[model samples]
Target: MSRKLDPRVVRTRQMLRDALVELIHEQGYEKITVQDITSRATLNRATFYLHYRDKLDLLYQSSKEIVKDLTECIDLSFEEDKEFDFLSDKPHIVFIRLFEQVSQNSNLYKVFLTEKNMPHFTSRIKDVLVDFILKGINHVQPDDQLLTVPREIAVRYFAAAFLEVIVWWLEKDMPYAPKYMAGLLMRIAIKGPYVNNPF
Candidate 1:
């Protein structure tokens, strides 16, 4: 039950987001000021203030919108039911959808994932992933059985690894296609690294 926003508000917000992103790239987030964003967006200081309390508020809003869209896309693409099987192709499909979403928003992903200065953005994303991973773990585990390793540890391990790989891919400008990366991720998820096996 969400109310629709005015079209003008939506347009103005998008303009501000685009301006902020452009400014961030040019001078980094720390150096960008409210005046810079307002000028870039063709809006006045009062208008910017009306929509956002400050520059950091604008940044949080932008980051939240991106994360919310990503979460909804992933959840809708990989809905879980009583019959849903985690060990089947569903996880792979989810991973593929994730990579596709990231590829679609490569500019924003590059800025948020690889930018060392944006720790808050990175932490927020990790928090989202950890929640999803915890749900995934429970989905895969039996109701009566307990995991040998703590659930939080396992969730954090996979979440951190996934984020690290994402950062690497973004930093390298996505040398591989999304499909190829998805395949590799699926294989690793199933077989894991063979580090302990004898050569």
Candidate 2:
């Protein structure tokens, strides 16, 4: 059995998270403190202590929520489909939705992802992508004997490529629309590396 968190508590935590992200952008993650977060959130120290022990605790929880939203963004786009349609434009649709999620929350991602001292947050996102890709690979090709490359290496390669594109997108302030970026990623995913593609 499980219990739902109070709505007030949930709202408070989100406010704190948003405040922390704002402060992180202004100063940096390593320099921000719990007091700074609470002050920016317009809440007091006692209220902050009631929810999180410290700034780092808030950071981990905030980053986890972002990753959860990203996972749900991708998952909800394909919940009705039991089988993947490789021949169809399904990859583009899914990637567009995923990128839309990031663009919608671009500020938080721009700060946490680009920050120098936030490797933990970045790694958590990569871990999510790696797990998602690994599961898909296993589902599509269940037989290990048929694999040309080690499963771990292949999965990491795909995950790193996806992560790098996302970072680049953020760095460039998402000059390309989500759908356009999705099409590019889908092509690379289906046709191997960009250099080998006929396009």
Candidate 3:
């Protein structure tokens, strides 16, 4: 049902996105102009305008693409009929794929996640995680009697903690491998701070 995008258009947009990433790294998002992006992309102002209204428009669209890719990664990892086990020692495929997605796009993630100036993008990422967690909780159907805290609060807490840890991993140059990080996240989610130690 969806129309196919022209290859030329796709290539041009990728160039613009790449240029934006490079410019953001060199200077910062606030200082980048449309001219800077076009120049970096080796394209002209007219061509740039044909695709986007302005730098912000380009940023929003590029970010949407990244978010879409991440969503797809998570979606693909979920098996519709199979329930995911949270207490298992093994890392979930969803977490593994999520980490792999971030690792593959580390540069873009570092810019988006660690940049204090880009709170909008950071919040967008959190929203995605929150939505995923809510859906996951519904799918798992845990008994309400066992939960000491409110479901919404727990969901938000987990989402925020997961996002912060990812930001830390990125800022620290990802010393751990994606698979290892995935397992660590699973352990933390299952046992909280008591993952390896027992009281």
Candidate 4:
């Protein structure tokens, strides 16, 4: 069995993560320092050091945590008993949950996705999406004859498009609700851009 984390430890880590995110928005990642994070978090250097070695370590751990949460959310959509029909009019639960998660954590995502200095973090998100797509393809077991292009190419294409759409949605201040976005993505995924036209 897994050990439960102390509530105090969780709160301190969240504060540090929030401070780092705020600092990244106000200035940028490269300009922020360990002292800057502690100051913003209203904690001292010793408390910060107790959890993270430096700002980079904090950023990395925070990013990984976010990605892990996302993976868990996505994994729920693939539960064996849940029948997810991509072609159905209804949006997949995974997309709804994924978008909701992103909306809830918009600030952190905006910093990770838009900041030029955090390409590695952005790439990590993309990698998660790619893995998600691969699992989906494996689970669904679509006809091989239907796929004209290589599976790897198709997976990357969908993953990149999904990631870009997220960046666009966040950049635009999330004009649409998460459920609406989820439905839209489901529609697009089921029927490509030229739904009525011949390829």
**Root-mean-square deviation of each candidate, in angstroms?**
3.1, 2.9, 2.0, 1.8
Give lDDT per model, in order.
0.80, 0.83, 0.85, 0.88
Two-way lDDT contest, 1 vs 3, winner: 3
| Model 1 stretches astray by more than 4 angstroms | 76-91, 143-148, 193-199
Best by TM-score: 4
In candidate 3, what are the lDDT values of residues 11-81, reduced to their tens digit? 99999998998889889899999999999999999999999999999989988988989888887424463
Report the Cα lDDT for candidate 3.
0.85
Give per-model TM-scores. 0.82, 0.83, 0.90, 0.92
| lDDT of each residue in 1-199, candidate 2, tens digit only | 7799999999999899899989999998888888889899999999999998899889888888899998877764343455757656546456788789889889888888899999988998899888767766676677878888888998999899999999999999999988888877776766666555475
Clashes of 1: 0
Tell me how many clashing residue pairs each candidate has. Answer: 0, 0, 0, 0
> Least lDDT summed over 10 consecutive residues: which range in candidate 2?
75-84
Q: List the residue pairs that clash in candidate 3.
A: none
Please give the RMSD of candidate 1 to the true structure. 3.1
TM-score rank order? 4, 3, 2, 1
